[model samples]
Target: MTSLWQHARRPATRDDDSWSVAGNVYYGTGRPIDGMERPFSPEFEAKVRHAYKSNGPVFALMTVRQMLFSEARFQFRQMRNGRPGELFGTADLALLETPWPGGTTGNLLSRMIQFADLEGSAYVTNYNPGRLKMLRPDWVTIITGSEEEPSLASEAIDSELLGYMYDPPTGSEPWFLLPEQVAHFAPIPDPEFQFRGMSWITPVIREIVGDTAATRHKLKFFENGATPQVVVSLDPSVTPEKVKKFQALMDSDHRGVDTAYKTLYLGGGADVTVVGKDLHQLDFKATQGAGETRLAAAAGVPSVVVGFSEGLAGSSLNAGNYSSSRRRLADGTMRPLWREAAGSLAQIVNVPAGADLWYDDRDIAWLREDQHDAAEIQGLQSRTIRTLVDAGYEPETVVAAVAAEDYSLLKHSGLYSVQLQKPGTGSGAPSPTPPTTDPEVP
Candidate 1:
């Protein structure tokens, strides 16, 4: 970008009053271009490539300082020379094109993106009075402030082209205190109001950024069970063949399904973890339903419980459980499992309602077979495991009984078709050979 100042480099012959900028602007101006306003060209890209290949690190340092100066309005301030916007320093610049090395275009577009973001926020921090009026007069924009923003319009947003929003001021300068302005901190405040203005208008600067990024190289996305892909241009209209190279760029990189699932459900916090246990050292006990309990257990150094939290943070996930896979929201239909379990003896089982005891088919049968006594059932229900005495059934048996289901047996056991005299062994029928494989075979 051309500065608001010009100095003669050589000795002036009376009327000649011009001077070249000295000392490398980092290594003397790396490449004198047509200027900053016009967009990139092949010639410009080539110049940038030469500058970087010859002196990238130096050019990068120079561009960084220039970007900061142009964004800071240091040169513009200096050129005013005690006129309207005068100041002094090596940081004198009003405007500047991004001067970093773009990978393909040889311009540093990624760096430009960072500079734009920083410049916008930095501009806001200074509380400049002239910035509101500095926008191109041709572009229509709206600014809002009750009394202070005299250069602004009345509405929070406007219809013509650009608009902005700010809080109703307690005082003129309090516009700086507005939370929306603070959180978003827009550059030149966005065009905003009439309710048509939304957060999306913030992308007006993206044309510069997008084109810059596209010219350099391609952006890529590697998704699990999907393509690792790249695109020449983010423009949706760009031909797909142009972006086909992304397929080759995407290597396995050791990313896995757990990473994908975490990206989906947890929305990408820290990456997923793995816990390996040596099976040879672990004892094998015939603990009934122990495998299923993993969903409820939340212990160990790395704890991961499924189907436990009722409403995880901000969303819903209680969608399934057990063989029956009871309706996700059974509470609507008196099927609060805790209540049903608690009231079975009295009428309103507490188990389904309060989540004390989950039902296992074998547990109910064992209770009925060995101890149909009311005291035993009620005692087990009311007392914690520690408070209750030995109930005759082993832990494994009780667990298996309570955790068991009859769904698999009901499916293929002909119970659905044959007229049943009684269910299970009570029918007094001879046992048939079980299927060699799964009863629910595909």
Candidate 2:
């Protein structure tokens, strides 16, 4: 039997169907080709890290991650007639349950999705063939081959060449990983590019940057020695030394949170004048609120779903709109992402032919209302079945017609008969009896 490790380590076949690069392929900028967009360089990553300082992006990211990780269940399924038949036990189950020896599947998936969201790509190598070892997106690069249809780098290097060059942060020499050895997940893939996937942060980087700046400004406003307006006018005759001493005195008396509200007394004919704008006047509230909305929108997360303070606006607060927003987020944003991740994971996991990975969202509280609605609909179906059966339709026919939504079943009854009696004819009078005749008389 071929060992799992050998199966994973075997270099990708260089055939027409294979996704192998023919010649030596070097990394090109390691960036998505969105026009006028910056590459996923070190500086860009720094800005992404800084964006976390802003409450909006953090909330959005957290909301997405938490929702995706929670209320999700995975199982290996058997394939029958090109459809998933039932949950079946496979080696993939154990691997997914514990992606790494120490890590849980949830944690592993969370890290992969988080990296994919922030860095535009996530690469996790199969260490010792099938065990997962997540590679840092920043340190890894795709070394392509000469052929446009890329082939693996065959030359031996210091480390194993699975298909990627991994340079550890602790000043280690670069190593290689096979394409099959790594599970790459990308949310928004560039249509033209093969190696890179587009990041959600790309479209919203502007909003995130604005939100970060706004948050910083607000922080500074509170941190500065002076509040909105309390100008201290000093005597012209006072020496520069005296001015310095007075400035220090005021700072000591009323700077920062601890002494912010304390009163200050100025001698030597100095005066304190109230100045232009206070924090309220500047309205960081509305500015930051707008920025938060933008960030959430760019992230494909509704502000209401993320529970942002500013998201408590009228539309979001309304029960109907809020429900609609939740559905939209789940359907439009999270479902597709879940499908993408499942598809990628399928590659690493030994998914049997005709069977694919799928997500079960039946347990998600956010979507429980849908279940409630379905129950109500089923109740209506039950009522319909009862009415039809009571009206002389076969029980099977009624169930098939109302429950299955297949009217054809109604006519499939062996009687091949139609009822001419009008509805509510239970009390109608019966016709007189006819004379009986024996078959032998004919």
Error of 1 at 62 (Å): 16
Q: Give stretches of model 1 more than 4 Å off.
A: 1-201, 204-442
Give me the candidate number with maximum TM-score: 2
**Model 1, C-alpha of 12: deviation from truth (Å):** 59
Tens-digit lDDT string for candidate 2 (32-112): 211111132453355345554334556566557655654565676555445455565566666777777787777777777
lDDT (Cα, tens digit) per residue for candidate 1, span 191-309: 32221112111232222223233323221112332223222223455456744533334223323333332232222222333332222222212121132122122111001112322
Local accuracy by lDDT, each model: 0.24, 0.63
Which residue runs does candidate 2 get wrong by more than 4 Å? 1-41, 44-48, 53-56, 76-91, 148-162, 170-173, 376-442
Q: Provide the lowest-lDDT 10-residue window in model 1.
A: 1-10
State model 1's lDDT: 0.24
Candidate 1 structure, TM-score to reference? 0.15
